[model samples]
Target: MSDFLVVGGGVIGMMTTLQLADAGHSVTLLERGRCGREASWAGGGIVSPLYPWRHSAPVSRLATWSEGFYPELALRLFEETGVDPEYRQKGLLYLRVDDEAQAERWAREVGKPLERVSADFLYAKEPQAAPGFDDALWMPTLGSIRNPRLGQALRCRLEAMPRVTLREGSEVTGFRQSAARVTGVETADGIVEGDHTIVCGGAWAAELLERVWMALPVRPVKGQMILFEAPPGLVNRVVLMDGRYVIPRADGRVLAGSTLEETGFDKTTDAEAKASLRASAIGIVPALAECEVEHHWAGLRPGSPDGVPFIGAVPGLEGLHVNAGHYRNGLVLAPASTHLLVDALLGREPILDPVPYRLEGRVTSRR
Candidate 1:
C-alpha cells in the first residue's frame, strides 16, 4: 500500500487519514495547531446545509450522500472512542422562510422531508419560540452534532490506529517536488517525505499549495458565534431566521451565530457581532434574553465560490491532491467528501461522480 501524507488535521484531513489507515495504508496526518482546534472545532454542526435549496447541484449531491452516512459514522466514532458526538435529529425550524415555493420544489426534487407547518403546531412544538409568524418550514429529519466532541472522538480514534501517525504542531511550509510529482512536504521541524501528499489545510490550503505553484482558490471567511448557557429546555430545537441560527444542545448550552465576514483570516470576536447574535438569539427564543452569554468565539471557514469544495488531484501535479474549500458545510459534508477522495486515491469505484470536485480550471477566482 502507498504511504500517504495528509495535511490539515481538521475534520476532513483526519477523516481522510482514518479512512486511508483503515484500508491498510500507512498515513501521517500533520496539523499546524492542535488537531481540530480551528474551524472544525468552532462550527455549528448542522448536519444539513443552512438553506439547502440555495446551493448548487454539487453541494446538494455531497450533502445528500453525507446526510445518509453521518449516523453510522457518528455511532462508530462514539463506539470506538467513547466520545458521544451528541448526534441528534432535533429537527430544524425556519421561522422566516421567504421562498417557500422554491423550498418546497427543491425538497420535492431532492426527496428531503419538508413540511409547511402552521403557527399553532410550531408554538405547540416549541412554545419558547417568539411568536407572530403565521407558519414555518420544518425539516423533520435534519440534525446536528456537537462538533467539538466529534473532533475529540476523531482524534481519539486516530491515535488508536497503528497505521496512522498523528503529528500536531507540524506546519507544512512547502512541498518537495521531484520532476512533476510532489515527493513530500517541508515542515517546521524537518522534511517529511511520503509517496503521495494530500493538502487538507482548511483556510491555509491555498497558501500551502501555492508553495508548489498550485493556485487553489480557498480563503478564510470569518464567522463569529456566541454561546448562551441557559436552562436545558429553554430552546428545544435548531431555530433559524435571517441566515443566523440558535442551536440548543442536550445540556443547557445554546449556540447563536454567525456573520460571514470576508475579513481574510481575522478571528477576533467583535462586540457588534456579539450584540447582533445575541439579539437574533433572543428574537428566536425569547427566554434566551435573560440567559448569560458564557462564551464568544470565531472560526475561519474555508470559503469557495458557491460553497462547493474541491476534492481531487491537482492539475499538472502528480501525487498531490486537495479536499478543502468546504465553506460553512465542512461538518455536514465531511463523511462523503473524504470517502470520495479516498476512493479516487485507492482506485476503487467511487461513491459518486468525482468530476464536479476535480481541480482543473474550476477555481477561476479567489473566494
Candidate 2:
C-alpha cells in the first residue's frame, strides 16, 4: 500500500484522504488547526455554482459530477458516524432583480430550464420574499449542504478507520525535496516521511510552498457572511439576488452571505460587511428583518487567477500534489476532485482532463 500524507484537513483534504484510504493506501492527515475549521466549515454550503452557465466547461463538468456524489456521501457519513450532514434538495431560486435581458440570454446559452415568473408567483411560492422583487430563474436541481456538519461527520468517520491517522495542530513547515521529488515534509516537530504528500492547505497553500522558495499564485479572498435565526418554514428555498444569496437550513437559521474581499489571511469580520449583507438579505426577504442575527464570521477562500481550482501533481515534484485554489466552490467540487486525485495517483485514467488544473502557471520555479 502507498503511504500518503495529506496536508490541510479541510473538506478537500479530508475527502481526498478518505478516498485514498478506502483504496487501501495508508493515509496520514496533518492539520495546522482543528480539522475542517477553515474555509470548509465557514462557507455558505451552497452545493452548486452561483451561475452554472458562467463557469467554464471544466468547472461545470466537475461540479455536476461532484454534486451527484454528495447524496451518497452524506448518507454514508450519517450511517457510519451518526452525524447528519443535512444534504437537501430544496432547489434554488435566482431572482432577476435587474438585467432581465442578460438573464434571458444566459438562460438560453446555459440550456438550463429557467422559468420566468411574475411578482405574484414569486410571493405565492415564498410569501416571506420582499414585495418589490419580481422575476427569477428557478433551477430545481441546485441544492446545498450543511458544511460544518459535513466536516464533523467526515472527521468522525476518519477516526473509525484504523488505516487513517489524523494529526491535528501539527503545522508542516516545509518539504524535503530531492532533484525531482519531495520525499517528506518538515514539520514543527520534525521530518515526517511519506511516499506522497498532497498539499490541500486552501488559502494557506502559498505560504507553505514559500518555505521551499516556491510560490503559488493563489491568494486568500476573504468572504464575510451572517446568519439569522428565523422560525422554521420562514424560508423554504435558497434564493440568490444579484451577487448576494440567502440559504435557509432545516433548522430555523437562515445564512446570508457574503462579501468577497481581496484581503490576505485576515478572517476578521467587518461590521460594515455584516451590515451590508443584512441590508441585502432584508431587501430580498423582508421577513428576515424581524429575525435575530445569530452568527457572523469570515473565511479565506483560496482564489486562483482563473476561477477553476488547481488539482493534480506539482511539476518537478514527483511525490507532491496540490488540490487547492477552489475559491468558493471547494465543497461543491470536493467529490470529483477527490476522485481525480486518487485516479491520477493510482495511474488510472481520470474522469476529467488534468491539464487545466496543473500547477504550471501557479507555482514558481522549484528548488
Candidate 3:
C-alpha cells in the first residue's frame, strides 16, 4: 500500500502530494480530469485575497503564511522543472474607498502597511485608469503568479520524483474501508488500496466523501472571468476599483473577473457575466475599452459556510484526512494548508493553529 492516496489534482491535492513526496513518502494522486484543469487553472492567479482584512483570523493566517512561502517555492520549482511560474510583485491598487478611515482600519486589521496616493500620484502610476478617486491605497506586498504555469511546474517537478505516482483521468467513485479505517479508494479503473487517503477535491470533496457517508459541508461557487489581449505593460499593476478587480499578467494578458453563483458544477459562461466583467474592467482602466476580449470562462470555488477550510482527520474514521473548502482564497492558502495537513497526518505539531480548521460533529465521517 502507498503511504497516501490523494484524491483531486488541483493546487490543494497537487501540493499535498508534492510535499509528501518531498518528505520521502510514497504517494499516488488520483484525478477526475487533467490535473489542475479545474479551479486552479481558471483562477486569476492573484497571490493575495481581495481586501484580506474582511476574512477571519484563521483564513488570514494561512494566507499570510502562503504569501511568504510562494516566492521561494516558485523559484525552487522553476529551477527543478525549468518552467518559470512568473511570480511578480508589481503591487495591488485599491481605488475608490469610501473614506480614509475605513481604509486605515482595514489596513490595521490585516497588519499590512498601505501607502495612500493622491490623484497626481495615482494618475502617474496608472495612466490608463479613469480619473475619479482623489486618493487610493497601494498594497505593495500583494503579487500575482501565472497559475497555469505554476500547476505545470508542480506536475513536472513531482513526476521527476520516483516516489510520486500521478494518475490523471482517474475519477474516484467511492472508498474501500473496514469498520473504522479507510483501506483504499474505488476508482473508475479499479480499487487502489492505500494505508491512508486524503480528499482534496475542492468543490467535489463533499460529493466524493458522501458516497462513503461523510458529511462535509462544501459547495460550489461559480466565478466567470474575462481575458483581454493587451500590449505588454498596458496596465502597470493589479487594480481594484469599486468591488471588482483587473489583473495584468506578465505575458500581455489582463484578467477581469468574476461573478459568484451557487450553480452546482455548471461551468457555462453566460452573456451577462461576460458583459458585467467587461464593464468592471473598462470602468477602472479606460485604456482597456479599446482592448478586445480574448476569452471567457468559469470555475468552481469550494466554499464552506464560514470560509475556513476543513483541514483535519475525520472524526470516527481512521486513516482518512481531508484538506478542502478554501473558497475564493484557495490559491493563496494552498501551500500552508498542505503543510499543516501533512504535519497532522504524521502526528507532528502543525505550524498553524488547528482548532479553527477542525471538523467535528457538524462534518464528521460518522454523520
Candidate 4:
C-alpha cells in the first residue's frame, strides 16, 4: 500500500485521510491543534453554494456530487462513530426583500425549480419571520449539516481505521524535498517521511507552501457567527437573507451568522459586526430577538482569487498535492474534493475537469 501524509485536520483534511485509508493506503494525518476545531467547525454548514449559478461550472458540479454523497456518508459515519452529524434537508428560503430583479435573474440562471411566495405565504410557512419581509424564492433541495458534530464523527470514524495514524497537536514546520519530489515533512518533533504529501492546511496553507518557495493564493476571510438556544420548531427551514443565514437545529439551537471580512488570520469577533448580524437576523425573523445568545465566535475561511479551490499536484513538487482554498464551501465540497484528489493521484479519470482548479503553471504567480 502507498503511504500518504496529510497536513491539516479540518474537514477537508479529515475527509481526504478517510478516503485515502479506505482505499487501502497507509495514511498519517498531522494536526497543529485539535482536529476540526478551525474553519470546518466554524462554518455555517450550508451544503449548497450561496449562488450556485454564479460559481464556476466545476465548483457547481463538485458541490452537486458531494451533496449526493452526504446522505449515505452521514448515515455511515453516525452508525460507525455513534455521533449524529444531523444532516437535514430542511430546504432554504431566499427572501427577496429588496432586489427583485436580481432575485428573478438568479432564479432564471440557476434553472432550479423556484416558487415566488408573497408575504402572507411566508408568514404561513414561518410564523416567526419578521413582518416587513415580503417576497421570497423557495429552493427545496438545499440542506445543512451540524458542522461540529460532523467533525467529531469524522475524527471518531477515522481513528477506528487500522491503516491510519492521527497525530494531534503536531505542527509541520517544513518539508524535505529531493529535486521536484517531496521526500517527507519536518515537524516539531522530527522528520516523518512519506511517499506522498497533500497539503490541506486550510487558512494556513500558504505558510506551509512558503517552505518550498511556492505559495497558493489563499487568504483568510473572517466570519463571526452566534448561536441561540430556542425551543424546537422555532424555525423549520434554513433561511437566507441577503448574505446572512439562520439555521435551526433539531434540538433547540438556532445558528445565525455571519460577516465576511478580509482580515488576515484574525479570529476575533467585532462588536459592530455582531450587532449588525443580530439586527439583520432579527429583521429576518423577529423571534431571534427574544432568544438568548448562547455562543459567539469567529473563524477564518480560506479564500482564493477566483473563488474556486486549488486542487491538483503542486508544481515543482511531483509527489505533493493541494486541496485548499475552498472558502465557505469546504464541508459541502469535501467529499468530491477528496474523491477527485484520490483519482488524480491514481491516474484515473476525474469526475470534473481539473483545468479550472489546476495548480501547475500558476504556483509561482499565486500569492
Candidate number achieving the greatest lDDT relative to the actual structure? 1
Clashes of each: 0, 0, 0, 0
lDDT of 3 by residue, 1-367 (tens): 7999999999999999988998889999999898889999999889988877777889989998999888998999999999998898888888976665766786787688787888888888788887777888888888898899999999898789999999999999998989989998998799999999999999999998888788899999999999999998888788997778998888788999888999999999999989999999999998898999999999999989988999988777798889999999889999999999999988788998888898875585545
Model 2, stretches more than 4 Å misplaced? 97-111
lDDT of 1 by residue, 1-367 (tens): 2399999999999999999998999999999999989999999999999999999999999999998877888999999999998898889999888898999999999899999999998998789999798999999999899999999999999999999988899989999889889899998799998999999999999998778776778899999999999998888889899899999899979999998899997899999999999999999998898999999999999998768899999877789999999999999899999999999999999998999899877853332
Ranked candidates, highest lDDT first: 1, 3, 2, 4
The CA lDDT of each predicted structure is 0.91, 0.86, 0.89, 0.86
Worst 10 residues of 4 by lDDT: 96-105
- The regions of model 3 sitting more than 4 angstroms off are 99-103, 364-367
- Residue pair clashes in candidate 3: none
TM-score of each: 0.98, 0.95, 0.97, 0.95
Q: How do the residues 1-367 of candidate 4 rate in per-residue lDDT, one tens digit apiece? A: 2399999999999999998888788999999999999999998888888766567777877888898788898999999999999999867888764655564676667565566777787877788877776567777778889999999999999899999999999999999889778988999899888999999999899889988888678889999998888899888888888778899898969889998999798898877888888887887788888888888899999988876889988876788989999988898899898889988987789877778788876568343
For every candidate, C-alpha RMSD to the true structure in Å: 1.8, 1.9, 1.4, 2.0
Better of 1 and 4 by lDDT: 1
